[model samples]
Target: MQSNQANDQWFQSAAARDIHLDQLKRVERFNGRAAMLGIVIGIITEGLTGAGIAHQIGLGALVDGYAACRTQFLPFCF
Candidate 1:
């Protein structure tokens, strides 16, 4: 009787684990689809705004200058 009870408990635990794994896999699939959708939206928005890759490089330069000023504690930065 004890052996049968132990086997029953083990089977229940295994079934529960399988159900949880299925839910996680479904969630991961949804996340991947959502990420792809976001990338498409970003591309469309960038195209409509006319901010090309060159504009992005100029922005990066400004950010780098700001970082250098902060690190040097320059008076002009204040």
Candidate 2:
């Protein structure tokens, strides 16, 4: 009887672990698909706007400011 109980417990533990792993795999696949979709959307946006992702999101000024400061040797450009 004790051996049977032990086998059942072990089987249940293994089944639980397998289920957990499957869930993790599904989540990872979803994340990968989402990332790919985001990249494609970003590419399309850039094509339409003629600007990179950073500029589209309003970071162009900061980047341009830094470049200007570097070229002009400004003491404080931040």
Candidate 3:
């Protein structure tokens, strides 16, 4: 009975750890996706639209990408 109780506590902690790891991975994937999206938008905006409008999407995408990356950047590296 005591061993079973201890096992339950370990499972709870492991579950919590898994959740944190999953969130970290998700944030990372989004960061990379956002960066690529921003670059593509910038190119299309300049190529088809014009420098001004292209820059608008480009800048917006860049900011979003940075924000996403910042979320996990430090923890990911260190």
The C-alpha lDDT values of all candidates are: 0.79, 0.92, 0.77
Put the candidates in TM-score order, highest first: 2, 1, 3
What local lDDT does model 2 show for residue 21?
100
Quote model 3's TM-score: 0.50
lDDT of 3 at 8: 100
Q: Give a tens-digit lDDT track for model 1, residues 1-78.
A: 999999999999999999999999999999999999977776776799866444444675566568789898556762
Give model 2 RMSD, 1 decimal.
2.6
Residue lDDT tens for model 3, 6-69: 9999999999999999999999999999999988877887787656552474575666556677
Q: Which window of ten consecutive residues has the lowest lDDT sum in model 3?
A: 49-58
lDDT of each residue in 1-78, candidate 2, tens digit only: 999999999999999999999999999999999999988998999999889877888999888888889998667877
- The 10 consecutive residues of candidate 1 with the worst lDDT sum are 52-61
Q: Over 4 Å off in model 1, which ranges?
A: 51-78
Model 3 segments more than 4 A misplaced: 1-3, 52-78
User: Which candidate has the highest lDDT of all?
Assistant: 2
How many residue pairs clash in model 3?
Answer: 0
Model 2 residue pairs with clashes: none
Clashing pairs in 3: none
Each candidate structure's count of clashing pairs: 0, 0, 0
